[model samples]
Target chain A: MADGTTTAELDAPGDLVSVADRLDGWLEELDEPETLVEGRREAWERYRELPMPQTASEEWRYTDVEDLRPEDFGFVEPEAARSVEIEDLPATVQEVLAGEQDRSGVAVQVDAGEVYRRLDPELEEQGVVFAPIVEVARERPELLEDRLFSSEVTDAEEKFWTLHRAIFSGGYLLYVPENVRVPEPVHAFRYLEREDAIVGSHTLVVAERGAEVTCVEEFLSPDLEETSLSVGGVEVFAGENATVRYISLQRYGRGVEHYSVQHATTGKDSHLSGFNVALGSDRHRADVTSHVEGPGSESEMLALWFGDGDQHIDHHTLQYHKAPHAYSDLLYKGALTDRGRSVFRGVIRVAQEAQLTDAYQTNRNLLLSEDSHANALPNLEIEADDVRCSHGATVGQVDESQLFYLKSRGLTPLQAERLLVFGFFEEVLGRVPVEGVRSRVRSAIERKLGF
Target chain B: MADKLLEVRDLHVTVEDEDIEILKGVDLEVDHGEIHALMGPNGSGKSTLAKLISGHPSFIASRGEVLYEGDDVLEMEPDERARAGVFMAFQYPSEIPGVSISNFLRTAINAGRDEEDEISVFDFRKRLKDALELLDMDESFADRYVNDGFSGGEKKRNEILQMAVLQPTLALLDETDSGLDIDALKVVADGVNRIGDQNQDLGVLLITHYQRILNYIEPDRVHVMIDGKIVESGGPELAEQLEEQGYDWLREEKEPVSA
Candidate 1:
């Protein structure tokens, strides 16, 4: 992706420059495999060569990063994390865990440190691996050497993507073997408590043929007085006949800026479903994509965001159907109140070889206040003549009729509005297969709605 | 002493943003435990009166008074009026996607009660179960979103279900029998009758364009409204007369009655 885009136009931000200079120190602290060490070095070099994304670029038309003062955030120093019990985790994390007890495993990352991780013995005994990515690299480097830095992981050429690659800590890895179906979902909680700290985390899931698994990851932090930053990446691989469901809940507190790039590729007859809930963060940009690589593969992408305060949430999604007879559907819904703003752009690309592909994309936004705003842009680029592809986008205010109906049933105006917003997101929430994830997402939305 | 369960005294209502009046000084009264059928032709201001009583913002009560148990009902917000035991069964109920009927009913029940008196989940489930059974609706109906994608019959039955569960002292049935098949109309009517029978003090104002529904759920008195005013009031015989002759006679009579 180094297509001669010169970085000479501008100097790197001081905050990110400081982080880049500490890469050697980060590498020294984590005794990792040679392959990963080389990967980090390459990523850091690319980070230096790439330029910060500008709003002038089409991909960032709605989000402006020039106002970001990342220097206000201090880099989290790497230290040996003291292992703690599940009970010792933060109260918020405990509350999340309390809602779901039928998990195959749970991992907690605090301030870019793995504090607690557990995998059911039965699954572990069956060669299923759920652990920190660094540990997995050190123990079984072969498992990641070919897949970690592969093109399937991230096609993004953005500087944040490279920055995340170079500095990510306490990364998560979930690998299921062939023909093994994990009955319960494995959960991960990434919590940041230190004020004004820059942190990065990476999550990778690989399912072999006929394997089935569900993973739920949440990013959480307490509201901070100063600005903080997070650059994260997520990659998923569903093998032949495999099924994988990933639910990501982003609940970073106010004064936090987050950038994450997520990509998934499906195998023959496999299904990959992803649900993203963005409720917090002062400024967040999420780029998600589903690549249907094999015939008969199915990809379902869903996201719901509730923004309030001065939050600015931007989401861009792509459904790329590269193989014939593949099916992909995307649904994104959001609600904004106060001075909150949201931007959603989605594209469905059907390649020439993807004949008979069935693809649909929809984005709906409910602006709850006059000051709140939402922009939705849905596009389609289809090269296959026989494929069926359609896209739709809508931006609307709360329906007075709906509100009146609820109010007439005895609910107050506030309660009625909240219920309407919740119901607006119900289309996506109802499809979330994981009960625990669904409940947690609902609670996060309630929290945003001040319930 | 409380004057009546509901008393509309020379009520004048107007459509918002329009100079034309929808209800011109109409007066009516319903006593406790009485079922009064309000019969009118389309666009004769029958629904307007019901909406004004329920505090629908689309219609303005430009003048006059709506008293509930001798208290000013128009002064209350829609929700407050609901908590005060005034309910309206709409002709075309608004469909609330994604909210289950059971959930909406529970929230409505809770909204009517004090915090300390919130209904328990078990009790709510039982109440919903009973209401559904009384409406002859499948148990799964409670799990579906409120009136979403429901057939006309189902929507009317749902309104009756809500009426049964809420047990309001006063119910304004706005053309509840308009879009129902015979069997569905019977089920919905039976639901209303059962609830009315259970609550002896329940006062119902059944608004309908046709008198077919009165066959199943009888009304103590029937009032014919023409041109936004009650032209006549009598017993069940009034409904039978309107059914045989239609509303043209009443529209022509235009004789104001002491309702």
Candidate 2:
């Protein structure tokens, strides 16, 4: 195991290492197991060696990542482990947070790297591990060693994941032992405090054989005033016959910039579903990929985003079928108002050896204003002739007739437009099984719509 | 004259992009407590007239004045017109996906009511329940998205439910009877009739391509519009005569005037 170099070793004139070095110093004190330390060291070296992705790269043709230099932002260290005051948040955020607490069985609040509170002690007694990433590393080194910073099954050669692996400061780590079923969802909340402050966090989840767990990660900022940066990575491992539902709601302030990468793998007969709701951020990018590594595994991916003002949100999803008889489905939808812009690129790939694979991808966008824009690209690649793969994309504005119908019933045009946009988003939001999480997402969407 | 609900004087409207004048110098007046049925053929501009009165942005009113409760409605926005007690039940209502019917209705009701006096959630729920009961709508419908995945009959009934809740002074039923089965038509007409009976001062401008809805909700006056103009006017018997003889006789009578 090795610890990464200090700021002095990496910083140079006109180089971004000075900011990166500051971030490194903040993470240097985080406790990690020997294996994880070694993995992170290797990841840091790899990040230094890898080149930033450019628009010329086929994988990043539609995305412009050159503007995301590290020098543009400063590193944010956890100043004080202050409890998040819900009353200080926007009414929409407060309502959503309160609603989730009322409905969910387990709620864990992570303020920066600190775990402020954890609900449902009984479930914690049932061999369910829910704690800060640092504690998890110290308590369950074996599980962390096996999965932490592991990129063998996923496509992690990208610059963003490399940087995330090298610099992630604090995150949540959840583990469900064999044969245990968690009825209530495990919640993780991460709050970003300063604008233009870089935040790199990682979440690792493992569910042993026949175990079931649901985890929700919420990202929020104080308001849309700061020009911040958040790069997050999450990895999920579902053991044989296990089931895991993961939801990530990124409701950053409008001034923040965000990039996220989530990779998940499922074992034989395991089921995994992931949802993402993007309501805030001036510019946001999310790249999520799921791999069915064992037969009979199933993966479902759903996303909904509402972009307003000058916000820009981009989402990319991939479902890779590596084992035979695996099923995967992806649906992403967004509504753009004002001059906001959004892009969605989704792909479903079935490997040659993955016979009898079933894969589907669909992306839909609703443009709420003439000035707003949306772009969708859906692709499918099938190497196995017996496998079924399909993809589709659609971009459209709200139907004027529908708006008229609502307006005729005394709804103002804005109210009618909001209703139509909400309806357009329902296709993806409806699939979320957790009522509280779904309501929270709904409230966030309404708030973004200025309801 | 003081009790007149809607008065259209020389309302000239043109269908966008086409030289066709759908509502050509049409004159009509509907008084409070009266149900006026506007019957015409496919190209008779019945729908256009209804749209013009409701302030649809697409319709260009070249020369006309639409007075709703004695105010010029031609300059008003669609929502403004609605708030001013003008309502039009669409022929094909748009389906809104994520918004629940309950939320949509409440927002509409609140927007139409006094802005300072917000209705309580309990009171709103009570009102919604009463209206839904009147329309025979299932309780589940309130939770479902507005008009999303609704059957044709269900959508029409929902329109009437909205009308009942809004309680507009001037209700324009634009082809409300179209695309509905006989059973659905009766249910929808019954709902409209109930609203009319309950709000006796409500004035209705019922626009229809067929006379079937007239059987259940009898109209006090009937007017035949052809080629964007009111060609003939009479009592309810005119609707029956046109339904029986078709617009062929009217077309022949108007063809000479065209030359």
Candidate 3:
């Protein structure tokens, strides 16, 4: 609308008008460095050029998004900088923050701008950069452009990926220098409060060689009156011998539709662990990948989701083993009730040079209602002969015998089911090393169970 | 209240999904503080009767009345029966992974009591410790998942431990001696006797194929079940007679009567 658009691009079609039409306006108000703007412009071009995902594609066979009308959701322009204290935040956001009292830093974002950001002075003095990406890009744009625009780190070529890159806002950048180990986790909270708004946020973590850090990202929103969209991205770079742990809890309201792409690449001898707990949103599709690119690297991916009230959730995971002597393990579990459904597609791909690559993947789903459904698809593509790779999947209902056994002990039906559900997820929950994060996840599960 | 702690009168049952009958007009009674041993070979519906009294969903009572303390037990659910102080030590207990025994037992105890009378953690721990010691179990056993990866002997011991903690008014031991060795059987029988002694009004229906368990836990009455019906009821000697005669003489005596 500002006269810089070419006639040919403007004439594209009605389908691209909603999100694409607002890109230029959002970019103008984004307030970033020139280099970052240029990168976003290129991403916008690619976003317009790529076609929308279709169910005919193998990647989306079980999840259909044709009914989504992007035009119905409007993008919010960047909000003016305002001083927002922790007490002024929503109760839901405050409750989550209170769960992790030992966090070294915390950032809270609402809609299109960050509301509050804080970091421990000691960590900042140690040359660690933990702040909003927009603020950091204003000072050193190169630091962000290099990672944001890197194809090797974010290989997702979907339309949503391009859209997120073009207009991601309110994300945090965590940078730990070599040999620095942060004792406490850094927390990032993203919340959506506006109705019929499309919110896109990003998270970037760079743990340099010999560094160790743990970061937890929590997403939550109040039950909105109208449906909205959330497109998110997370990129992690674990350098040689560095140890990084990233945990994300998605607890959006039922009126929200979410699409997230999470990618992590590990260097030699680096250890990376990612845990995702998704229990919100009316519809959500998450693509989580762990790229083991260096020898002696280890990656652990764990996720759990609970769906109720006709919610539809889908997850696709990739364990890409490109170096020898790398180990990757993934375990994803989900539960559904009240006609809710879930889809899981996992791939363990070992490259030819990746000998001695040990990869294991397991997906289990518990159906609590007869009408609830789940589909699990696990695949292995190993070009290396010496690699040890295995995958397993199971979709089962709550065992009546187990329920009876618990009930015979005098537990009420609801209590029995709750205990069994927690029991089913205990294996993964116990694996979470952080006490604060584990308890927060446990409380979230209790909330989902309507306790 | 009823004179008998448990009264099963002319009870008949069949598998819920199958047409075959399991319990054919079974009749039995156990007074307060009495131990009645129901003996029969495999497939004599010994377990079915216990399961039916416990309200297992698989077995539906076609015609009968199961009265516990003058209340119709057939009208209640399994959980309701459990809350009413009726307990059954399963022949093969279900394994519930990831649920610790301590947590499960605490939840069960709290569920069976009134909301305001819920047991505190300290009290529950003390009771669990006492029960474990009574069964000669180590403290670590309570930390393990409920019956998961437990040996057969351990499973039986856990059942007895649960019985000790719950302290039910009526207890049904369904083939509790089947999978136990001589030592395990002795430990389990000793546990039952100790619990019975502690709860003076406790009534037990001990179902077993062999009379070996009767040696430790004396029985006031022994009922012989052959082909879904109790053929004879006598004192503890009936158990030894069936154990020695191998249920054949009873079967032969019944063959002429049926013909």
Best by lDDT: 3
The list of candidate 2 runs beyond 4 A from truth reads A1-32, A71-112, A115-119, A153-157, A194-197, A223-228, B114-116, B257-259
Separate DockQ for every predicted complex = 0.76, 0.65, 0.69
Write model 2 residue lDDT over A195-282, tens digit each, in one string: 5567787888899999998888888776746476788889999999999999998887777788888889999999999998888778
- Per-residue C-alpha lDDT of model 3 across residues A1-451, encoded as one tens digit per residue: 0112112210111222355467787677656777777778887787667666778887888888766655346766655334466776668888877665788888877787776777888998998988777777877666676686463433333677877877777787899999999889888888887777787888999999999999988889988778888989899999999999999888888899899998899999999999988888899899998989979999999999999998999999999999999999999999998889999999999999999999999999999888999999999999999988999999998889989888887888888999999899987888887887777777877887888
CAPRI-wise, candidate 1 is medium
Candidate 3 local distance difference test against the native: 0.86
Residue range B194-217, candidate 2, lDDT tens digits: 898899889999998888999998
lDDT (C-alpha) at residue A369 in model 1? 85
lDDT of 1 by residue, A184-280 (tens): 9898888877665688889999999999999988999888787778888998999999999999899888878888889899999999999988988
Candidate 1 accuracy as lDDT: 0.85
- TM-score, candidate 1, is 0.94
Worst 10 residues of 3 chain A by lDDT: A1-10
RMSD per candidate (Å) reads 6.1, 5.1, 5.5
lDDT of 1 by residue, B1-259 (tens): 6679998989899989988998988999999999999998878899999998888999998899999999899889999998889999988889999898988888889886688999999999899899988988789999999999998888888989999898899999999999789988888888898998899999999999888999998999999888888889999999999889998877656655657
lDDT of 3 at A206: 92
